[model samples]
Target: MTIESESDHILFLSRDLLDDIELQRLEADKLLLKCSRLARLSGTDEIKQWIKLEMEGYNGSKELSDHYMSRTGRWTNFAERKGYWGPLAQIEENIRVQKLRIDVSKVESLSGDGLIGAMRMNRDAQQALANGISSMVAIRSRVLNMLHTFVAGVYYERQFAKVAESTFEQYKKDVDALIAAHAGEVLEKLPSVVARLQEGNDEAVSQALTTCRRIIDSFADAIFPPQAGTYNLGGNDLSLDANKHQNRINVYVAERTDSKSRRTRIRQNLSNLYDRVSTGVHTDVTAEEAFSLFLNVYLFLGEILHLGVAQTKDSVMA
Candidate 1:
């Protein structure tokens, strides 16, 4: 319902936006195909009313320019000051005037490639249709890319939450620091998503990515959070039961028995899980691969918890 992250908002909105743009492009293609069909039926041997028909459709097609122009209306201020208005108006007027000039027969009079060109559609009408479609496509690609980045970041955080919150804070202070750094990276990426919505322009996407990368690069303090720790001998620390403190099947298993070898294996398992997920975070992995990794991390955190409990029991026995 309420999407908190701006990037997430864009990512979610993009699904519908792409559908609408693609639908418009399909409509434009159909309109052009109709023009081509009329051209063929009339024959290039003599000028027909195809051009007049196309101009009429261009004016009548409510789907063509309205959405794109409305979205990019703010940019029109720059487009107009740079003298784009004259060319834009000229294209509109040419299409408009052709509707009344049915008897002019200018397109049919032309021979060779000129005639071939008219057969496709009126040149201006073809261009207008193409521009509208291309602009929509460009926006779609950028939005899709933004969504990809946001999804990947979410994967990292979810995976991290499974691992980082598995151990007590006082026992593994460095691990908590690592989780804090990761939280900072995730937060840094969220604020710029508002700017992304203002204009889905190239510059906006680039700026958002750059900001996120800068924060990611700053996380040099710790790479991996520890999974196992002893009791909080120093009672000054806060005891917020995180993912680390809870959901540990290993800890439950360890409390039942005194076997030391199985506990060592649990410690090794936790270490292997951390290494695997750390690599996953720093590299490219498909969605399937990422999800598999998240499950693996979840299971391994439980093993880490078990190892921590076993070690604490052994220390008490000694």
Candidate 2:
């Protein structure tokens, strides 16, 4: 199916990949191939690149140059473990702990009769096998999540675009000045963020993260200014503070009973992103991570702005 036509039936593809991953029916290479195709259909450019690294390996991907899986050094910790049973069942790493990239296509999987078969031999051959299949599995789950969100976004954007057309002229007249200033400033950041990231240096990474925070900060200020300390919601006073985008964003989302679930999801996504952005400010963040963080600001903003314009529908008509 052509990209446009098959998009209507994307859920089918999503479910197929889900089934494959859940059942462990496909090898990492085949699974990544499927995910890469699925991702190309509806995922963002950045996410598509993330998947590409798995399929093609980080051989020549400049954006992910820092994350190349060249040295699979067992990584920060438990990553060195070959198997997980009972006490070894769980694996945890710090969120800041970066995962080593692997080219799933290259990993040679051990095939035998489960535990009994796997115990039969110890290859101890990382150099020989180059096991990147597990990293491929992570991509499967990620692709599923990104697909769901991207498909939903496509639907939302279409529905909102229709309303936006009918409501645009009137809405602008009422709230253009205040909204435009923040929106314009936010838009202006796109170029600066691009320039900084292209530099591909530590300082550039920091600048990119700072820009991410600025995007959130500007969006928060527009929707829920810190100057407005108390948000009177259903007559309950919820507090707000400067630079505290999460609380302000939650308050913004809470105002909409009809969409609190989706809006809250968006807020939480941004909240998690904000934390990552904050972490990058203090720690070393790759250009890849910084770019992804910046790319996401606009994703949530689309839903937020759609709801935002709806919030002004009555005032505009009045």
Candidate 3:
């Protein structure tokens, strides 16, 4: 798989991991390696350390759980079977089975070979399970990887609180700011939206979609209007496209904000809202979908407006 950026690679790896997991065709060792890479990218020491431990497995016999460290088997001597340690103790001891030292490599080979969850090897499945090696592999691939939540950044064991805190609210804020500046018409139409939704007509959906388009177009107009010129970005003089709102937003936001993640948000929200609502629907449109369109129109406006705000603030300061 050829991927470009760090974020793209992360996204690709995660998608690949999830695809295999959901399909239940998981490559246990391969999944571990991807998870390890993801954990490293997580930028948290705790997550990294945990993944490291999982990949390395138990250090030595001392660290291995007693359950796996030794195997218990009942030994029988037919001649002396009766009451050697008395019936009760003898039965207890016979049933109890003596614990003997076992090699970690014996059970561990299952995981090392990436065979888990019904995937058997030369050894009997039940016998291999006795060491709990498959369980450890599952924990690393399925359990630990799921727990990491590297994309979200805050979860059972990790840091990156700042990124976690800013998720939806930041998106909402961006949309709100955009609406305030460029959605005057949409706002006026909003008073009728509830009634329109109640009527359950496709017309309402069209109206909602059109309103979204208007606001975004207005937003684009406000920030980067149609101009027959080029924007000199660093040493490159990139010709401006009158039609490509994404390009405009990218250049503009990239100029103002140092945060690549924030720029990503602006581009994503803008593209989704603009592309989704831009095209008219031929099939039946539900009031729920129309309401969703309306909700998205409002929420997708603010961050773009934030760029404008920053520009205004800078101008005033100058």
Candidate 4:
């Protein structure tokens, strides 16, 4: 048969390349086993003599003839004249052909087996890809959380700072007015009276007053607190009733939209890949195409997973 016809026949017989490999391997192994058994039964000396005769001819050297006679216990003249070499040579040639067939079969089998092994490898790659994707999603969530937490803390701190600054400014104005009003009576006691007046009665007001004093003492503190370094919106407290409720609604809507889009894309890609693989396996595509598809899916999954992991790390840092 033509090479193309043979290949087509093989594809028709087995959809999977692995199945073809396994069958050829099995056939080769059987033939090799048969040959080994035949060799054992025939005896090594007999086999050697057979090989020697096949190498030489019936009218070969006396030395070779004598050696063959001694090993097989058959006189050279009787063996040669009766055409013993002819039958034995044919048997040896058959065995050699069998061995060659076995070897060739095994090579072919292994080629197909390797492809199947590659397919299995792709599965591991796919899993890794999935894991990577999941990890990235997790990382993104974490980054977002940290950012939220930072924002919340900053917001609260800024609000407190504003209140404190306002209170301090008012206190400064009041002290100036009191000093101006009592200027004639207590010129020397102005500082002490201003200090007393600045100290508010209520606990919250007192705290605000203290904070204002600290800000005034250190101008840097008023602009930026030492503890609040960077603003991150992730990992912010989600327990605030109004903020929590609003965020929940937003997250739900976002998740639904993302889920729908992801599903549609994945389904479409899978369908396209499936068609390519199927066509390649049977007719239009070559062995190379089949191999490529397997590799493509494997690589695609891995890339997705890698992206996910990166996103995850970014989220964590955030």
Who wins the TM-score comparison? 2
Return the lDDT, model 2, position 276. 92
Per-model C-alpha lDDT, please?
A: 0.41, 0.60, 0.54, 0.39
lDDT by residue (1-318, candidate 4, tens digit) is: 332553343323222222323343333233333333333333255444433443344333556664553443333255554322332333345445544544443423334557887756655665555554443334323322332333334334545665777786875555434433422222233343235334533432333333322222232221122342222223443332322322332232333344556545544554465455434333443333433554454333333333344555777999
Report the CA-based lDDT of candidate 3 relative to the real structure.
0.54
The sequence of per-residue lDDT tens digits that candidate 3 reaches over residues 1-318 is 887666556656666655565665544445556667777764567556544543443222332322211211111232443112111122223222321222322454444445764345434544644444333333334443443355334222222333554576786656554565664554455556556666777887667666656655655656766677778644557566777656665677778887768877777777776777766544466778777876766655555556667877988999
Instruction: Supply the TM-score for candidate 2.
Output: 0.41
lDDT of 2 by residue, 145-212 (tens): 55445445555554465467558656444433444544767666667988999999999889888887
Ranking of predictions according to TM-score? 2, 3, 1, 4
Over 4 Å off, model 3: 1-195, 232-242, 310-318
Per-candidate alpha-carbon RMSD to the true structure: 20.1, 18.5, 18.5, 36.6
Candidate 3: Cα lDDT at 14: 61
Candidate 1's residue-wise lDDT over 1-318, tens digit each? Answer: 576665444434433334434454334334334333433442242212322322332232333333323332312343343211222223444444544453343354566766776755666665555564454444334433433343344445544553565544443454333334444453344446445424555555444434433333222111222244443312423232333322233344345456668655654665465455445445544444434544444344334434445666888999
Model 2 scores worst on lDDT over the 10 consecutive residues at: 86-95
Q: C-alpha displacement of 139 in model 3, angstroms? A: 38
Question: What C-alpha lDDT, on a 0 to 100 scale, does residue 136 get in candidate 2?
Answer: 37
List candidate 2 stretches off by more than 4 Å.
Answer: 1-182, 232-237, 313-318
